[model samples]
Target: MAIALVLVLVVVGSVLFHVLSPWWWTPIASNWSYIDTTLVITFWITGFVFSAVVLFMAYCVYRFRHKEGATAHYEPESRKLESWLTAVTAIGVAAMLAPGLYVWSQFINVPKDATEVEVVAQQWQWSFRLPGKDGKLGTSNVRLVSADNPLGINPDDPNSKDDVVVEAADLHLQIGKPVKMLLRSIDVLHDFYVPEFRAKMDLVPGMVTYFWLTPTRTGTFEVLCAELCGTGHNFMRGTVLVDTEQDYATWLEKQATFAQLSTPAKVGALATPAKDVAKVE
Candidate 1:
């Protein structure tokens, strides 16, 4: 009786805890509420399986309890039971994976109208590059990475000369503008994640990965490295701000382009702005 009572309480207690839990996803600031919906679907399917399995075990223990002169039934696997289990398990697995496949399809296809933004991740730090007046970013190479050219943009790629570099600073995006984030890593594997954006992707040393999102609201969001890189992994933090059109333009103007930063004569003049930007969250 005590064992059966505990088994029933497990299901009831767990359900109550989940429904009353204060911990929940942060309010979404992007258009990927589909991600949250998919998660809930997954949870419900898995939770049902968990509860059913536990309850079934309890039922079996109670129904098959030994009695005076009772002998255990030695019947081996039943074909009907096996068939039912197989079909039900297949359906449950399909139900969990189907929604993710749909979300993944949307994740990789970037809209042509979306603005391109480059995100460069190194040990415990994040930098960003955005197209400048020419409306295109120049090519970059990891071999060219250095203190003077941290982003490694090809100096000869005229397309890159006007790229706005936001080094060691917060990235700002215009609210409602679709952005195709181009991710790269200089040192090791990292992941660019913003819970509010409902998106993240890995940064591999020799490869680039991408995901796109349109900022659906104006606010500042924390950037977290979702992958464990090294001892400094926990410190790999940054911020992204979604701004109004006018505010975005103003912030854009304040940032220095590659051409400006690379010029020796303008280096001294740029230091103050760089410091101010670095101070921002």
Candidate 2:
């Protein structure tokens, strides 16, 4: 009786808690509401299975409780029950995977108009690269990363000369404009995530990963490195500001281009362009 009561309580309590929990996902600020829908479907399916299995166990515990002299009845297996379980499990798995496949398709099919922005990550800091007047991002490599060129833009690539760099600063985006975020890592793995956006992708060394989204509203959102990095993992924080066109244009104008940062005023001294981190706040 006690076991049965606890099982019943567990099911009822979990459902109520989930429904009433104050800690819910932050209000979505981007165009990935479908991701939230997928999560809800997953929760409902898993919750139902959990409740059913626990209730069945409670029934078994009470019904098969030891009696004065009840003889045990052993059945090696039930083929019918096995088939039913197998079919249900397969259906549940399919229900979860089908939505994921759909979401993945939408995620990779970036629109042509989506502006590309590069996000570079290291042990604990994030940087950004945006196309300059040429509207094209330049070639980059890890080997080219240095104190002066933290983003490693290839100097030889003429296209890179005009690429704007926003190192260690808040990324600003024009609201309602689609953006394709290209992810890169200087060292180990890192994941660019913003809870409000519901879109994230990992940055793998020597390779680039990407995802696209359009900010649906104007607001300042928090950025985080979802991957477990080094000892400074917890401090890997950044910001993404979704702004009106005027505000975004104003912010972009203040950033320095690759040529500006790489240009040496004299023989051996590179021009020290002002950093944007201080100005972005």
In model 1, the runs with Cα more than 4 Å from the true position are 266-281
Model 2 lDDT, residue 95, Cα: 100
State every prediction's TM-score relative to the real structure: 0.93, 0.93
After superposition on all CA atoms, how large is the RMSD of candidate 1?
Answer: 4.7
What's the TM for model 1? 0.93
Please report, in order, the local distance difference test score of every candidate based on alpha carbons.
Answer: 0.92, 0.92
Predicted candidate 2 versus true structure: per-residue lDDT over 221-272, tens digit per residue: 9999999999999999999999999999999999988888875542134333
User: Per-residue lDDT for 116-222 in model 1, tens only?
Assistant: 99999999899999999988989999999876788888989998888999998999999999999999999999999999999999999999899999999999999
Model 1 pairs whose backbones collide: 138-160
